[model samples]
Target: MLEIKNKLYNSKERKMQKLFNKYMGIKKFFRLKSEKIFPLNENEKILYTDKYDYKEKNEKNKSDKYLSFNKRIHILSVIPKNKIENFYYSFCNFVKKNPSKNEFSKIILDERLKKSILNYSNSLNLGGWSNLGYTTPKSKELENIVDYFHLFIFNLSEDYIGLDFTAILNKDFNHKLNEFMISEIKNEPNYCKYYVGNKRFISKTGLNKDIIRREKLDDILLEIKMRCYDFLNLYFDLFPLNNKAPITFDEYITNYEFNSKNDYLLRCYDFYIFEDKQISRDMDIIINHNDKEFSQTFLDLYLC
Candidate 1:
């Protein structure tokens, strides 16, 4: 555990290093390999641990509870290292903001959140948003929604960079992300007036109900952004392709199969290069033995 911490600390991923340094207990949890089921304090019950004599216990009794639990823990252990890191940071950040047991339990049990985080972790393990060359329509749509929402928050409030657009959309507008777009834009004036609007959206007069609501919203947005960025920063660290070397020509040919060369694939292929001299030599040998004309055309199109 200490070795892993030291390695991560020296690596370029500072966010992950800081997370590990701040929450060393998590490292202990992951590293535990005991084979005994121990009791917790008298007041605590249902404390799950991976250390249980599953084989002996299952043979002694007909029950497979210990065996099942141990299997689940083993499965968790096999989760990609990056995903576990991301899950830890996300869990910690969520706990810091909402400490109540009920709140924490609700989030853990949320199926959508779990699935989304897992999918995101898988993407990070691969290459993240930029490396996703040609995605399905649904994925493309979600990315567009999130990206445009960020842009909308900036444009709506004259480049205000403090609000948590993701949280607001997740909590209040999960099913209707575009809800506020048309309504908010309706109040905007001609081009020049937009540059001189007040920082606060609502008025502060009379009972000042709108002002209080705006202030409260701002505070919630700020809190949400804090958690979101904390998760994002940690996830960015776990994203393996964040600062990876460009894909070599041989690697590109061996790994990926392009059915049709669309503009997006063309753009991505252009980014792939032969940095390693050996890989470049191997690619030339393969190209010579294969369809030379096709290879020449592909190189002409994408090779830098």
Candidate 2:
């Protein structure tokens, strides 16, 4: 009987010790180092590199001409105002005629209704805040008037994947769209060039920030550009512009390249080394030259 009691007490003590050790281990794992207590300036920041002198020289001579160091690359395609207007008209007509039980119907109808209300408000001079004394009236005919909404093709891994026809409704539409698209592309089965090192080794030890060789970096950038081209092609294929011949990849995307000595890229590399996972890259798009005018018109007509 005494032996059994001793065994039970020993087991309980072992369990308590295991729990306490686990808690401390976790706490230690998450604790910030003394050096990280304060923010470091660009020059003072510590990077895991053997060639510190070479890196410093490179940083001093770094050019600001290339695209940002963020893994995502922005590809811009411009559509003529007339083409966009035509597309909007066709889209509205299709939605009206088809009347399907999909979400597209609601989106299109709602936007149309809003546009009508905006036009009505403009005619009454109720929402005119612009310096222009008179507000221009929008045509009642959908085909004659241009819509303010921009179309966004969103692709998010494990989250959302679809089109956002009313992207302009949200003020942070650009950021949200880019974030979702990047997340979606990262989930692609072939998107693994960014994760090329021994993740386990890097995690057990510390990551060498200069692990990415110039040749490897070049390959990664090329792959990223190709991926961007493919993404743009897919979007255009699904929704052709003005019912015209499919635009060539070059026609759709003007530029896709990475800049040198980007801190964001370095941080992303560190994250992958430690987490054994890839973070979504960022991207920016060049809006059409007339986008500003169109945006102003949209604000004047709808938002006031």
Candidate 3:
């Protein structure tokens, strides 16, 4: 009887271990699939380094390998003027506490805060959104808070593209916020006007909102043009314009423009070098970006 009981216990432990391993295997499969779908930009690749277990690897090599996971921390929310203070303090306190061990028990002190914070461990790997209220297996202390803060912000705002928190996390909060606000003015002029009109909120944040709005729009515009030029340089290098003379970024942008959806499709195919097999495999990415309805549906899967 004793021998039989020991065998049963051992068998059950083995089964549990097998299940855990299987779960991890499935998770890894989907993660790889997602990466293949949405390739990370160069700047983003630098900040995305949490996928691997550094403990098993050499200590010296850990930092190098640990630097490659999420590109930007994005938040897409319209945080109300009344709740800004409460949200900011709650977030600051949460960060200060660094409660990775206790999980969601102390995530938000205010039960009145209705938005459920979501965690996207990998920005590109949009398999599913995990609730911040639960502890993720093997997640590092405070890693989720810093890396996945964007999802929380997404729940807050209804208008405009999400805010990029990458600059803020990298200790360039003020500069990034100014640039973002400036960008917002260009992208949604009316929205920016309304947001900055709130004098009380502007005072509370100590943002250089007035200076940028009044004096720096042209500077921001020039900076944006430079960024686009640089981005095109990278883009052209990755997806060369076949049969066309290698042109300067300025020349290319000035002379060549996508006149229609078909023109864009042709350019996309050129990027893949017109390899039938490769194009067929990666066509979904091209379609998702170019096709407005499908793009919305695809985004809704993750953001909605």
- Model 3 collision count: 12
Which is the leading candidate under TM-score? 2
What C-alpha lDDT values do all the predictions have? Answer: 0.27, 0.29, 0.29
lDDT of 1 by residue, 106-188 (tens): 23325654454444433423322211111111122123222211100011122111112122122233223222211122111
For all candidates, the clash counts are 0, 0, 12
lDDT rank order: 3, 2, 1
Worst 10 residues of 2 by lDDT: 295-304
Q: Let me know the TM-score candidate 1 reaches against the reference structure.
A: 0.17
lDDT of 2: 0.29
Candidate 3 Cα RMSD after full superposition onto the native fold (Å): 27.9
Candidate 3 residues lying further than 4 Å off, grouped into runs, are: 1-70, 98-259, 263-304
- Per-residue lDDT tens digits for candidate 2, residues 1-304, read 0011122233675567646545544543444243377544433232221223233221321344222232222233333322333434544554444333334333444665435423322243233221101111122221112122233322222222233232111224323323332231211011011234654211112222233332233333333333333433433323343422222111111122222334543333222121122223322122222344532100001000
Model 2 CA lDDT for position 198: 53
TM-score of each: 0.17, 0.21, 0.19
Clashes of 1: 0
Candidate 1 error regions (>4 Å): 1-168, 171-207, 237-304
